[model samples]
Target: MERQRFDSHQEHPPAWISGYHLVYIQEGEGIMRVDGDPLLLKSGKVVLLKPDCCIEMEVRSGKPLFLYDFSFTYTMISDKPRQAEKVALSTGHHMLSAKAAVQLSLLLEQLEQRQGIEEPLAQWKQSILFQECMHLVLSDPVSSEETGGTREAIEKVLLYLQEHYRGDISLKEVAHMHGISASNFSGVFKKHVGLNPLDYVTQLRIAQAQRKLKASQPIELVAREVGFKDPLYFSRIFKRTVGVTPSIYRKHRHTDKIITLLPHLNDYLLALEVKPFATLPYGGNDHINGYLPYLARELQETKLTGSWNKPDMDELVEAQPGLILGSNWFPINLETVKKIAPTIPIILRDDWQSLLLDFARFFGKGDEWKLWMRRYEQKVMQAKSLLSLSHSSRESVMILTVTCSEYRVYGGRRQLGKVLYEDLQLTPPAGITTKAHYVCVNLEQIQAMNPDHIFLTTNNSNPSKEQIKNLKETKAWSSLRAVQKNQVYEVESWLNGHAPIKHSLSIDVAIDHLAANRQKPWEAIGM
Candidate 1:
């Protein structure tokens, strides 16, 4: 970064650079030529120059143009070291957010302050701030909303291919499913997914083939398994895509590090005793994120990728994942993530166990999944037995969290609800048994249910203890049977404990805590 002020009518010849050049139009206005196009440079507008794009300048009518020029190379998630054009910097020009500009200025100031300093902590702070500034610069709120539909259409196509890719398919047939013409779907799919329909399917086939070949399966059988009727054609595509024949690739098979993006996927990976190279955060604090907090000691070393749905491309590239496991919960850009490695999206449905099994099968761990399911069943049964021994069969349990003082009863098929309502055979109180996502209950609504036991977790959203004390003083609270009986057990809500393994551990912890806290049957354990 350097500051320069040019006099009026000053003309500079075109120049090419090796990195992006962003000029913060501090004052005045001019015409900056970019890519042979004359872009009107003005105050409050950032002038972005791509690496190869030439910039010819002529100060137009105004005071001398004073600007801060920032030149930096972006090694972020691009397929190649190209100039950043897609992010708020292409076409004519775009408005920079005042907040973002201020943030960048602060970061730059910090960086300048630490130029000669040797403190590692100071340097790390500057680095993080600089990265954050870059992220903010890349962030333009308008594009995310506009591209949302585009992302969905592409995802729908991808899912269709996933479900039916093993059979003979064509572009028209798939496009018909989405009610779009072949030509339009082809263009949209390529634009968003970076591959035409035929190419995508062929790549999908090749990816599946690679796995089967690695298992030393027969070339012909593998071809049939991945949807190729003609083994000869399959072999040709395989060699082209993988750069090797099936038999040769199989002989050189080696395990590659898998990157699991969703928190549950990370826990699911850990359940098989296989550590991921990196994963997304299950929880902000290690304690609240996943089921096996104990195993977090091993996982704490893993990198927490940038965002959930749309992770930072640069981070994905750096991880160098052999396989990427993600969920459909986020707006994950399939085309971009695939550039780093083969990316697979797992749809998180009500059937989390089924999701786990799917992952297991992908990793060739079907047998392990079955074994885990058996042990999981055993664990559930044990927890159920212990819980049944505590409260009467007629007694009910309520699972809820206090979010900003309102009680959000966990309904629907979420993991915590499943563990309490289904796995433990614990009947929910009258209102919570149905299929609603969550019933927002005020103090009166909370008091109305008045169950035998209440299992409450604050999660990270609840009010402070002082606020709870105020709630307890209300007539609505004192009238509750659980509160009067001292059965309002405050438990940890494992935010990341949505996976089978994590849910199992969470179930045990809940039961143990419930058994220990209640005065009736398990007071023996509590004290």
Candidate 2:
């Protein structure tokens, strides 16, 4: 598949194009008259045109509009006409879903990076990625009847169930949530999802229980935490799902303990390298964004250092840092590092949960990891307990930041985004997709949303004092309540000052700063 963006106001080819053309609107607004049928285009929306379709587009935006266009071809071969029919039915060609858009963007980025590379290795990697894209296009269910309104409903229910798996939810409650009779809901859900409601609930509970167990929790407590009322029944379900008793599963899960020396630490014996493990935030430059603080706390609780990036290699050679955790993207020269600290170990952490597991094993704190995880579960419960609390009469306020020139507005899903929604309970405006870890929104769109507070992420290196003063003086910015009231604030980049672990502290400070200006100062607001 080939992906590119077009922004020509002049007319181009009038001839029909072969293969599928999927276009996502990135900015501005326009209309494409396809075969004399007008199709409106707006930001965040995607349109898919089939092969050999006549097309003419007219854009009306003041500035150039951006569209992400993907083109691909597929061959259909079959035993008979029926085979061709089957191939046509099975081939994936549909409008890009919001989730698919995020994935495609990631793939396109990788492909762009290798566009000029000449190595055979680069060619092989590109070929593999192209094949994967083809597979994704052909396997997506959007073109099938299986993915209809009922399927969408099932997806929503599944999401809700997954998010609230720890809570006491029943089939009747789920049915009522969707405003359907229990029997009808159960039949339709089964037909579309291939699992009965009760069975689905049981599977979700069991999966969560397994995660808890793997973290080294006691089986009985894990069972109750997952909503299993009876320990014996939970054991039966666990054995049926995993082919082993809970206790046996836990005992055998730790069978592997292969510790390899980091490319930088080959000189020391494995036994001599036994020291506390520490992890830095995945991205070295923190800027107080994402789940770094939570991950850091987990690391510290497990007796690991929260400051992995600032490790003193010379001191570590003597003190022995059993393992230093980093991400796969770090730019360290591992060979040189190993020569310097041969006695220390190194581990890479890709996600929050995996980091927890690595800490558990390295510190011999497997059991403690389980206990802390349980406490996390309890904290979640306490947060949900406020569902019945009276809603506040105060107006809601949101903090938005614009760092890069793209004028992107951060959304939930990025560390800062997720904290804003899940932790601080702020609601983002509609028509925004969770594609960009920090969303890129145009200035006009930001004004349209009209958030109460606009907290800009500024580096001293950028937006020099003069630029900052000019921006504050702009007519458009001056109209904003935040700008008018001087609510704008600057946060340092992680390495420069705002390290990942310090983000929570920064957020707390920002909240207090905002609260001090609010009319209702008594409202609770803290990280």
The most accurate candidate by TM-score is 1
In terms of TM-score, how similar is model 2 to the real structure? 0.35
Error of 2 at 385 (Å): 8.2
Q: Report the CA-based lDDT of candidate 2 relative to the real structure.
A: 0.50
| lDDT digits (tens) for residues 1-527 of candidate 1 | 67678777666777777677767675565767666655555544555566766677778543477677778765435656655444533523454554454445445555556665668997787667666755665574435622455544565677678668899897887788776667688887786556888898887787678667767889999999999999999878776665446654565334456777776667677766567777765553334344235556767767677654447678888877777776687677777777787666777777778777655645545445655674565455546556666653458778767655566777646667777776766778878864555677787777778888877776553353446667778888889998888878776655424677667766655666565333222221111
TM-score of every model versus the real structure: 0.50, 0.35
List clash counts for every candidate, in order: 1, 8
Candidate number of the best lDDT? 1
Superposed by TM-score, candidate 1 places the C-alpha of residue 169 at a distance from the truth, in angstroms, of: 26
Clashing pairs in 1: 289-496
Worst lDDT run of 10 residues, candidate 1, spans 518-527
How many residue pairs clash in model 2? 8
- Regions more than 4 Å wrong, model 2: 1-321, 339-354, 366-399, 402-406, 434-436, 459-469, 484-527
